[model samples]
Target chain A: MKILVPVKQAALVEDDFELRDDGRDVDPDFVDLQLNEWDDYSLETALQLKESHDGIEVVAVTVGDDDAEDALRTCLAKGADRAIRVWDDELGDADPVVIARVLAAVAQRETPDLVLAGTQSSDLGFSATGVAMATFMGWPHAAVVVALDYSPGAATATVERELEGGLRQRLEIDCPAVLTIQLGINTPRYASLRGIKQARSLPVEELTPEDLGLEAQDVGEQACGARVRKMYLPEKGQAEMIEGTPAQQAERIAAIVKEVMGG
Target chain B: MGADRALESGKAVMGGETVEPQTLIGRLLARPDAYAAAGLLAAHPDFADHRLLRMALPDRATGLVFAGMRFSPACLLEELGGWQDSAVQRRLAGNPATPAPVIARLLDNSSADPDVGPRLAAHVRTPTDALPGLVADGRLATRVAAAGHPGAGHGLLLELAGRGEMPVLRVLSARADLSTALLARIWERGDRHVQAELLRAATCPRQLLAAAAHAPHALWRRRAAGHPALPEPVRWRLLRDSDARVRAAVAEAPTTPVELLHRFQADPAQRVRIALARRQDLPPSWLDSLARQPGAWLQRWVARNPCCPRQMLERLAQSAAAEVRRAVSRNPATSAFMLARLAADADPWVRAGAAGRADLYPSVLARLADDTEVDVLGAVAANPSTPAERLAGLAMHDDRDVRRAVAQNPAASAAVLAPLATDPYPLNRFVVSQRDALSLATLEALAGDPEPRIRFIAWKRLGALAASH
Candidate 1:
């Protein structure tokens, strides 16, 4: 069984919050780097499944800048045997589609039976990326898989997803396709000191987009269809002071709310 | 990037060398107090240990409620759909075996219990009102804080007691009303920080800082009514507050007297300057003096204050700030020539302002109504002097804001507003409904509008029409 695990640097994940900034794009310098929340779960689930099923090889792949090698080695430390880093000339303005395109291209060479990624990148909150990637390949897609049951020989996997309004649904799909794993699929075990020593010696191959026969405009920031207008602080008003004993205060609050609600 | 980055940073010692789930579970179960600490810690979103604690939480109250171990009595009351399945309800119903003193103290389900109020003051430091129990679990949390009591960190017992609102009022209050300390800490440093002390002091309704209740800045002096002042130095010390909200409060007080008001005028916060401008009692000269300042808020002041000097008005008109010039030209007192000149101003905002003035030259108003800027055209439509024919023509303007403004004009004829009666934007529909010419049938129809504010306006208009009838 061959599984493709897409690994990314964590620093990019930490910077993906709505901090009232005008900069829509991520600043590599400010990246608070950490392991991707959902990807860790994906890695762990794959490792566990590999342990259960013999003759399984987990292939770790990363699409990023130079420091991404640091992140690729992370998957190695987590027990994956080999890694591949796709070196891109300039991926600066790449939007989600371009990213999916590049990743799809990179995965095409090995033709792994399973390709896994985190449901949505926390940095971009680009949830549609994986689905778009699956669409590009015309393969069945499943998202936010909280739990999974994999049958290697049949190449089929059933997964459960968490939805808004406290709903859960399960979808089963044939493999040789894309699946975005939700966090909490499994607890990612911390890499041990021994695991660290072995990770440095692991074979990590570097391949450029040219190696994958992909063009420059295929990914990066310009292909990204968004811009930052201006980064300015939010306007605010005076905070109201509420007074009185808990009971009187509650009544006043109720009265004020009732008045506002026009009750 | 969560654990992904944690992965590259370097591996752990297993912090003891076992990666198995059973060993992890053993490590967790090995420490009994850690389990209870985990339960208490689960409620804190700042920490994710709650999920780990969920593994041991037994069948009841397991997994993520996201609210943590001790549920807000208010939220529990909301879900009291079935109390038998709820441990919180069971504890509150007087279960002596409950480990938490708060759950036991929170019980007092007895209708005749006179001590329930003081017993539930754990939410806040001091009782803001008679509903101490409604705010807290025991005496005001401030009393406990002031006592520097050994057991203060017994968790949210103090926090809950000091709170003037929420779960306590729903679950603990048998009678009327609930008090709460809305003065939640936004930025706190340490246990001994001044903000913590101030908020704690504020929570206790019995305590007061004279400056907090009646400081010159309307925002700063807003504590309990008739409370004592903060010492003069302390009040002065707050001037350096980094937060604009806190500083703005210090700057916009009615009691701030002219001296402090002028001092706060130099505050770096533009909001504070605007807050001061909102005070109608500020001298016209002062408003004029502040009009020259480069900021949108100062322009807002110039707009509201018609008494600003003609020199300042002309200077403002020539000023690069579009909003400031817009404010100057929008003022009804500005001469027609000024309006005429500004109507042709390159900036869309200045043209929009010129378009809004009822007293502007008719030619200028006409030019503005046909201006390139959609916003300017909208302003022209709202000008009361615009002829009903012009209103009719612009009533169908493609821009929703412009058409809505036209529909809102008092001069807009019923015939003109009628076409826009079913306009997709609620403003246009409601504007037509507000017209005196609108028949009672139309007004009644609008009374059923889905928008509450629109319907409310309709009701008032209907009442006035009824009174005239």
Candidate 2:
């Protein structure tokens, strides 16, 4: 059985400075660095299943420019058997539902028995991507999996979906299916020294929607399910830190209390 | 020798053998000798901000020394009353005698300082007449309570067995050291807002019992019965109290003398009589009296606790309270003559408690299960001796709590649990979910249960079942 894993990356370090959109009208540098926290869990789940099931092969896939290839390469280095890069330079501001269409088109070529993705990409965090992908593929989906089990005839997993009001409950569903894993599932194994060396030699299959019998017209901002009308920081006020001797500070605190109490 | 200069020097000397800055502050903070520190403060204007200097002068006598030092009153107020660790206030309140001048200074200047909330609260015990309302509010209560001196720590504490004065006891009780004093205090004014503090202080059983025992009045004796660890005094009173709660408190008393229980059985309170009927070692005559009981209430209570003296129930079958008579009728342990007596009872709960036993009569529990009163039905539902088939049948009767009781019974079968599986209350579902008797299929049925709490328990149970494999 083959399993397909999609990996997304973001910068490891937070950039303290404001983002500057380069001439392409995109912040290429942000995409040019690091991995998303959620996608890392999805990547690990696939790798672990392949390690335990001798015949299974895990493939890492992504859809972005050359910078994203660095992230896919990182996945391969971690133990994925192969890498697939779907180069799409114009898809930066695309939403999840559209991205899901693109991803499903690419994934059709692999004919994987099961597909794994993160519950949500931290950078975009639509959280609708995996569900959209499952709908597009017409496969049963179980999300936020905390545990998994895979045997030939029956593959099942237990997941805890976060619900309204900070509540969580477990759910189970059969797989040969799509499963989006929440963060901190199984610990992701790091690339071994030998694995890293072997990863450098692995094949990367390059594809586009055209290669998968799809059109670019099926994606981009037009095909997106939602719209972001504005982006700006919310107004904030500075926090005051009162300083004085303990007694003086205490007195101030007491005075505040007195005024509040109207004493 | 220059006598004039010598006299000036005597008064101006900053430190002496017994009055070194450190010892003087430490001792003065600890005793009435605090006058020593006061004296020092009087001498030195700079020492008010001198926390170290005041601390170093350890004795209370040094309050005077502090006063003598002309310490800046502003700074002394700052060091003494600043929100700080208990060690700071503990040192001050521990002073057997506080310097009157310093206290005077506090009263005069307490409101003058900005941090007067905690400071004024801290000194509430300083014998000032102008306290109550200022001390009662939240800010002061929390700060003063937190700044509580060690001896005062016993205010609300349940375990303090010491015989201190009422004020000290009040202080201890406030801190959650629930004891006789607290109970008595609660008893006296427990009906009023005074109970708010006691309620806050003693939520636990031992403390509740101790507090109840010491509760000042009979009303608290009944109130104490509503809570845990029956207070000894409340227990003693409940052995004769008119209220069911009081009697229930007596029934829970681990050391209740059988003789006291005997006298309690004859008390005017029917609830007391009902309570006495539930005990295991009730005298034979008590069972005899129950046999003739006319009321269904007596029989229901009797049947719920089946081990009581059988002879009294035999005699109680003839009581006017239909419930009591029903109790005599439903008793399985009742003799043939006893059954004959209870069979004539007007109330069904009484008959149900004394009804047909295999030894003399058929299980009358079935008849009582159909009684009109919800209370009797509840009695049958709670009675362990009721036949499993009969109990299962009652699981569907309208009351959800009775159904809950039936569902929770160890003897309840799968057939009985299936209907309750659809119970609206999560409590009933939780009971059905937890019973080992419920198969994995039942748990699966509850997996999609609407109540998250129930669903959570079901999931946990499923996980445990999965792990055993």
Candidate 3:
């Protein structure tokens, strides 16, 4: 059995950050790149399944530039059987749907028993790629999968989908399904000393879009579902300070609440 | 990969590896060995500049190695100044071999790396010219290191004192080079922590110790009470400090007049009496008198003191308070026979304490293995001298804790630990997986275990073994 996980390196904006010269995003100098928080949980889920069963392989794939290889190496350090990185200079600023198309092409060749991904990326919480990839592949997929029970090569797997207001829906999904894992599903383990040493020597196979049967037009901004018009820090909301003794402060709070209610 | 490609692309843009210092320095510093990188850069001075080296030294370790090299050219160390990374800059600031001018350059960039300021201030070779920037640094550690610097003159110390942060003042108070004029100025504004440092210095004027002994703050009085230089009259004044802790400090001071020590024996505060009882250097007569007290509090401390008279330990072994008896059981002064008696103590905790001792006879440890209470049995399971047969028996005891303790025992033979590999508790199985001498069959079995955490660890160990072979 093989489980494929897609990961990304999310950029974190530091305090006192400045906008890029183009005013489209944070400046690169003010950003630190790390593995997406949700992807760590998703990869741990795949590793847990691999450890509990025999002859199970986990492959981590990402559609990103060279910097994104760090996320794939982190997955391998946590016991992924293989890592594949697909990148091309033309894929710059490609929206989530284009990324989904690139990942679906890799999935078509590998044909994993299951695919797992974070419900959303930390940088852009689109919550679209996993379901979109499933749509492109014409395979069944579930989102916010908080619990999963599956056997290698099983005809179907049981999963519990978290819903609005703390509700959960249990369903049986068919084999070769895609599941976007949610946080708190399991506690992820840190990379052990030996695993880190081994990951350095383990090969991370690099591929271009053409190697995955993708064309330049299929995985570029032209294929995007949405384009960002402009990005800026939103104007901070204002707050008023009320200073007085307890009774006077209470009176001001009551007046504001009454005014807000249009009394 | 992108960084390497960028380096290559820079070369491609140059048409060839031309003599342009930018391309030449980049190519030469790319050498894996720091010495080779430094040697190449030193041999070609035209390619060395602070800006160019800053751009080339992101690897950081190469810069750190050359920054500290004694024989590296001063010009190279100077040009290696103020890399973007604080660690590289810190290494340069801390290196005695770094030229004073480079140290000054690092101090100028202290805002970019606050860590460099403190190290530069603390470096022995730092010129006085850089002390002003260091003293004004926003980071308190930098200011404190500057205040403590040997070359810091009285004027610089006065300026640091003007800032008046307690930690910087504390460092200034402890400086041997500080003059009496400056010391008096610091004593007036310093807090208890600084005053305590002043009292600790043997050269501290007798008048300052005398004033501290009568300070309004109880904590200051407590510290002053212990100062060896305190005037005899002031020691008597401290004995009357309303705070028991202050009186207790006086009670424990070696220089405390014997008459005061005798009065402290009858001091109203039990805390004072306990302090007097626990002193290792208390004359034998004083220890005997404290041991003769009715309460267990003073005797328990006396029993635990290695210098406690042997006669006092024998009496403490029969103490009604289990804690007092337990204290005696673990005391190194307790004789073998006394330990054996404590092993049979009626209180299980006392017996548990006796069981954990490293010096207890094996025969007594074996007898403790039969203790009904799990606490005693658990301690017996962990004792190094417990007979293997008894440990094996305890390993199968009904309590999981006993079995866990047995699993943790280094003395447990592989035969004793083998059965624990499949113990019902996952923690026991986890402990079993961590042992060094597991048989291959057991390790292979654990590698396929149901628990994911244990399996991960066992597989790592197996991989390490395979690599070793």
Candidate 4:
């Protein structure tokens, strides 16, 4: 069995940020990079699957620069058998769609029996990459999956998905599918010293668009269906505070409710 | 057709020497593993022309060997052109042995089976020119794939970023390589949620900060006030803001002025006052007053404050609230005499807190080690200040936790930890595995323990010691 999990490296803004002189974006110096929290859960799920099954190869892939390699190394330390980093200069401004395309390309090469991805990224919260990857693969997919059980002999998987308003839906699907995992499906384990030491020597295969038979013009910014136009803070609103002794405040509140009711 | 007769008749002359079989099929029949024979036969150059071999081969064997076999671009294209099985086509599409032309043909064939679309889309060999059409495809998945395509054009990205939907904006925001101009535009048009995210960027523009400072959502305002880049004047305004929570956020800002911290000390909200009390810069005199306050929570904060004066700690040691006294006992600044006094407090919790202190006098630790309360004794066993003699004594305690604590103590003598090396509980044995003072002989003994977990730690510690040498 082969499982492919796509991980992302997200940047978090530090409390102190200074905009560039151009007034266009925050200075790069102030951003702190980390693995997306949701992807951490996704990696944990894949590792857990590998633990329960024999001869299961788990591969972790990501689309980012060198910083993303750190995240892949972390996955390796946590028990992923291999790591692939798909990066191209043209993909720097690529949107989620472009990212899914790159991932699909890698998936095609690997032909994993199962693919697991975080439901959403911490930075963008698009909640669409995994679904889109499944779509591109033309495979059955389930989102926000909180529980999973796979029957290898039957090549079927039963999954429980968390829905809005505390609802849950359980569905069974055939193998070779994508499951966008939600948090709390399993507890992620910390990488032990031995694992870290071993991971330092593990080779991470790096692929470019050319290696994937993709051209820059094919998956660059031009292929992105959407782009961010502008970002700004919302206007602040004022709250009305009822200030007085308990009795006076109560009287004021009653008068207001009575006025609305009478009107 | 008898097996014996077939074997006897299989010999033939070939290449001027005696051969097992003259015909390929005949040769395959003589092999022990027919599948291995078929795989080898499938790779032979002349096998394509052998009608009998093609007929004799199973589809699974043909597909597996073909997928794994090397083929020129021209041959792969011709084979793929005639391939009808979706599964086989998918295999052909993914095989690196398959030439680029074949992959391109599959990618460009709009009329191909729907299953072919994803395989082609995912094929690294697929042409980059196909990404734009896929990105604009009617299917949501294909469109998404194109969005992530490394070959996606800039115009397409600009269009996606223009969408008002959160999903589209989220995709756009994740682009670390986005141009500053595009990022600014996204920031301007983003809703409050998007705006809040932009504010989290290390390079958040001043304009965004100004806008967030007055955002309709107090949450946004609070976040903006917490920004390290927040202008001094803007922070001052937020300091006087009506919302206590926002004011509290400002108080928490590292750059918040000392004068403002002093002024906020009088804030009517207890949360705001608590936030102020936590600041290391808070005047010691103020801590003195707060320590005397009637609120147990406030006094508790003062007790935990490292900046809290020794005089204030002395006052807090006598606190009526057990929690406050415990905090005082835990303070590293507490005098040895005060720790001894607290170690004998009527409340077991205060005594336990003192027992855990590393600075407590050895004599005080010995007294606490004999406390009737199990928790106090356990804490004493764990304290580094506990004398080695006391540790050896405490190691014999009947309670597992107390004994476990003795095993974990860094100051425990070899004599104290030797018995625990073979303790009944695995956890006690595990703790003994971590003691630095253990002899190499003891660690070697543990390495052969019955429990695999104990052996693992014992080996790890042994490895660390070996590396140190």
Candidate maximizing DockQ: 3
Q: Is candidate 2 or candidate 4 better by TM-score?
A: 4
> Candidate 1 versus the native: TM-score?
0.36
In terms of lDDT, the poorest run of 10 residues in model 4 chain B is B1-10
Q: What's the number of clashes in each of the models?
A: 85, 165, 0, 50
Question: How much is the lDDT of residue B395 in candidate 2?
Answer: 82
**Backbone clashes, candidate 2:** 165
List the global CA lDDT of all models: 0.58, 0.57, 0.77, 0.72
**Error of model 2, residue B440, in angstroms:** 64
Q: lDDT winner among the candidates?
A: 3
- Residue B373 displacement (Å), model 1: 2.1
Q: How well is candidate 2 docked (DockQ)?
A: 0.01
In candidate 3, position B84 carries an lDDT of 62
Ten-residue segment with the worst summed lDDT in candidate 4 chain A? A14-23
Cα lDDT tens digits for candidate 4, B1-469? 1111111111211223222223433544454222333332333333333433343334543443444344322343345445665545656655656777677666666446555564455555666777656555455445444444455566766665565455456555555456566567667566666666666565677777887777768877887888888987788778888888989988888888767777765688887778887877878887776666568997888898888888888888988899999999988788888998999899999999999999888788878877889989999899888888888888877777999999988777666787677665667877887666665455655655544456545544433332222
Better candidate by DockQ, 1 or 4: 1
Highest-TM-score candidate: 3
> Which rank order by DockQ, best down to worst?
3, 1, 4, 2
Chain A of candidate 4 compared with the true chain A, TM-score: 0.89
Candidate 3 deviant stretches above 4 angstroms? A5-45, A89-203, A207-263, B1-79, B82-91, B94-119, B128-145, B162-171, B174-177, B189-204, B244-278, B283-304, B309-469
Candidate 2's TM-score reads 0.33
**TM score of chain A per candidate:** 0.82, 0.80, 0.91, 0.89
How do all models score by TM-score?
0.36, 0.33, 0.53, 0.42
